[model samples]
Target: MATLNSDYLIIGNSAAGVTAAETIRAKDPYGTITLISREPHHVYGRPLISYLIEGKTTLDAMKFKPETFYEDHKITALLGDEFEALTLDPEAHEVGLKNGDSIGYGRCLLATGSVPFTPPIKGLQGKSNVFTFITLDDAEQAWAAAVEASLKASESGRCSRVVVIGSGLIGLKAAEALSHHLDEISVLELADRILPTVLDPEGSALLQRLLEPHGITCYPGLTADEVLGEGDQAVGVRLTNGECLDCDLIIAAVGVRPNSSLALEAGAQSGRGLIVDERLLTSLPDVYAAGDVVQVCDVLDGSEHPLALWPNAMHQGKIAGRQMAGDETALFHGSFAVNAVDFFDISLLTAGVINPREDMGCEIDIYAEDNSYAKFVKQDGKLIGYILLNRPQNAGIYTALIENGVDLDSLDQDIFLETPQNLDFDNEMRWERLHKFYPRDLDRRGWKEKI
Candidate 1:
């Protein structure tokens, strides 16, 4: 095996890993940086895979950065199966790859992200025409399958149909994209409401209404008990209620679990996800973890879990990169659940704790008119969470309030009664909030000053 060395080694080539590499390059221009990924392609937006399937974007146009990204940053990229990381020896500050190569590093960032959690349904294994929506490759394969199914349905004089198992963000997005090509798309969600983690019951109902008109039907409170198959090909699904539904394609979007096996094997501490401190450092020295692979404190609830959101991953990666470059002041401020997604014409922007336990004494406010719906959740008179559907005005102001933990009592008007704006707060408070948000927008020096 050949031995390679680098000043900084970043595993995973998606959002978090790429952001960390960029941050490190900006701070330490001369450092030898290396990035590795199991994916063969260049960096692209994982969330845009559905868009790619919808024909809204091409494969080339989905690139997150230019083709010359690695060369421009002077970073070495080892991608695809040839460089798949198999082992992490934190004691020796080295990683073993499947290609019989070993890499030594001064500092390492594990941004391995998450893996799809496929439930153990009968006849689901080794099945054709069943896919998961995560990687760019998965999107391509599923898109091709949809095209084939449509052609076959046309010959049989029947409408093309697909069954998506899971009504969360991934499953619905997959349904939306496939709906454009197929005649019908059915979403099977085990939860009573769709987007269970991101939206409340009312918000979910409002969104489901919009999806129904676009040839997408959501079956809540039910899931696939078995994937009925014929010769290793999934033909239908048997629901827990014993109802059978035919499908040309089966997309398993149940959810994803943190991809922390390598870190755990290397003796890193974990609680559901890899545990990292303020500097994003793992239990092992000189080994940091970020992105979906690491658990982070949720500012709203103060609970630690792997935040799989893209923005949080980027923020964590930037902080980890700074710390690895010797800037200890780069600290994580924790994050809450924030997401913005659209299905057809229906748009949703949500943040923080949309659902609170009854024991938390949270004050809830909701407004629904026509197709628009807004819900606010507050605890101790502080805005903690909100869901905005089809009404996207002043969403940043709401997010700012939740992130900064601004007291509602400080404002002169009820933010729920009217649309929130910067003028809602006093001039001094407005300036303070704006300054904090843009401190690092100029240069890296500004980051230290703010922190």
Candidate 2:
């Protein structure tokens, strides 16, 4: 019921919102900032959710910032409150919230993030044992349900089996988590291979070999037709091929869709996500958008696309915040679908543009083995993309080279085949450029220290 006036108002508390709040506070110290989130907890790293399942980190450790961050930055954080509706008044430069309150803001940012996409499969709604992995609440519920099923089975001498739909990062992580508690865990992917968007068939095959020893079953090219339930709880899943797999739990990890309905209903331009300009500004004046809710331009294709990565959200938020604070910084350079994931002992790192056109002119170099593979795609003498498995040491160097459009002709490809330590930056111009960008490295060890 309380009205508020702020210099800036940010919606959602994910990577984008958190970074936007901090960036704005850094630029405009005296400007009042209000951050609203539907989530109850403070901002946390979404990528670490998988590690959390592996017991690599606890909930507190996943927090991106401390609980007192907002207080210290003089930002008002509204947790556990949903921004149900958005009504814009151009004359007053104000927005009305569903909580019967209005906020007058000099600038507004919509970092609403995204929501998991649940396919329209029959018997899904009535099933209590079926779940989706997305929010913190979803992770907590999944963990609790998995543990409970395991414990109950242990007590009653019954079998506990879990089926995970979708073979992307979320499904893989969920399967890994369930494997820790349940004896039988299977991942069913609709595509021919896992991580179809990021990794090629060769890379997926290597990962499958690594995961097979961990008691995780991988079923590729299988589609879920319906959720099979007894009474009100899901007991198994019915596949499109008429195969029914009995299981105690089913976790759906198909994908996520941008939560941009509010923006659309408010008359903001939207497509797969809220459409925005290079500056992350929506069609509505004073209403900027970022994070997974907005479609961002891809650096390689120069086309608007949805990249739901956490780093992309954070970087986009920084750009939005800076522009909102009256800085004329350029729009965010689009992101490549880069990922670093590990299962068992093998690690995989993928970066830059992927899926080369068959007819398009591009050079492809591949080094494949039974245990690992490395591939690079180049166009116009510039490194465009790469995929590395089991050999992740020099990933940063490749990422830098690809991002900066560095001419790879001067560097020997064989040099990169070795460890990152073997690479030489003795050339004065290269060293100077690298040093200027990574000044901290230069300061730590005087420029002459590493040669």
Candidate 3:
């Protein structure tokens, strides 16, 4: 077996892994850095897969960094290799790859991300045409298959329909992209509301109503009981509620499971995901984890939960990378479940404790206008959560207030109706936030809008 040695070994090459690598390079200029990737291409923003299918951008432009990034940092790249096992030795920390290569490292990071969760429905197994909507490869396969299916159906004078089994982020994005090429698109969700995990019934209703005008219908509170198919290809789906719909393509976006078997095999702790410290260090010494594969502290309830947002992943990767490079001062602020999505013409951003339970003594305030809406939840006199729709400019300010635990006793409810000002925050908090986020060149008058 071939063996290699490096100062740092990264198990995945996507968002968190790439961020860690760049941070490590910044801290240690000449250290040996080895990055392993299961995919064939360089690190790219995974969220762009939907855009790729929509023809908004090509695969070349999906990279998270420049093409010369790895070369510029003198990092050794190992692409298209799956990691099989992680073996931590007392004398030498080593990792085994499926390609029969072994790597010895001073420290290692696992940012393996997550895999799509395909719920088992009758007649769904072994269907060649049924695909998951997660990876870039998955997007490419689905896009090709959709086009071919539609064209073939056109020969028979029939319109092609696509059934996306979920109305969450992944499913909605897939449906949006497929709508560009296909005539009919339908999204199925097991919950009564679309985006149930991120948005409440009202917010979900608003999003669904906005999308319905664009030829996409969301069927909530129903799921596939059976995937009706001929041979190895799917033709339609039978819902659990005894409704059958015909479709040419089946794209499953039910959600994802963290790829953390390697972490468990390495004797690291695992919950819903691999448990990591504030430093992004795993249970095992000299091994770290970040991104979707690791669960971090949630700022809202003070419990460990998966904060699967892209910004959280990027920040986690930076913390892990800095720690691996011998910088212990780098600490994560906190992480919370958050999502920002655009459905048709409406843009929505939700974060922290989105749906506050009245049973939990949560005080909820709502403000709704035509094509614009805002909701805030306050608990223990502090901002706990918020949801904003068709209001992009106010998102950052609300997020900051929630993160900082600003007391809402003196807060103006009118702030929800318009852009909040620095005056909305107290004098001390205002000065602190201004000093922290104030731009260098932009004057105060021009910059307060951004706060």
Instruction: Give one digit per residue, the lDDT tens place, for model 1 in 1-451.
Output: 3299999999999999999999999999999999999999899999999999898999899999999999999999999988989999988999999998999999999999999999988888898899999999999999999999999999999999999999989999999999988998999999998989898988898888889999999999999999999997899999999999998989999999999998899899999799888889999989999999988888788888889989988898899999998899999978888999988888899999888989889998888899999999989989999999998888988998888888898986667766887778987787776677564555533545444
TM-score of 3: 0.93
Q: Rank the candidates by lDDT, best first.
A: 1, 3, 2
lDDT of each: 0.91, 0.81, 0.84
lDDT of predicted model 3: 0.84
Q: Write the per-residue lDDT of candidate 3 for residues 1-451, one digit (tens) a residue.
A: 3299999999888889999999999999989999987787888889999888888888889888899999998889888746444454523588877777789888999888988887878898898888898788899999999899889989999888999999889999999999888888989999998988888888888888888877798999998999999999899999988989999989999999888887787688888889888888888888898898888778787777666678888999999999999999998766787678776667888888987766769988888886777888888888788888887775778888788777765566567668877677666667777687667766656654445
- What is the clash count of model 3? 0
| Range of the 10 consecutive residues with the lowest summed lDDT in candidate 2 | 420-429
Structure candidate 1, residue pairs in collision? none
Model 3 CA deviation exceeding 4 Å by range: 82-92, 409-413, 426-429, 436-451
Best by TM-score: 1
lDDT score at residue 251, model 2, on the 0-100 scale? 90
Per-candidate alpha-carbon RMSD to the true structure: 4.5, 3.4, 4.0
Model 1 / residue 290 / CA error / Å: 0.7
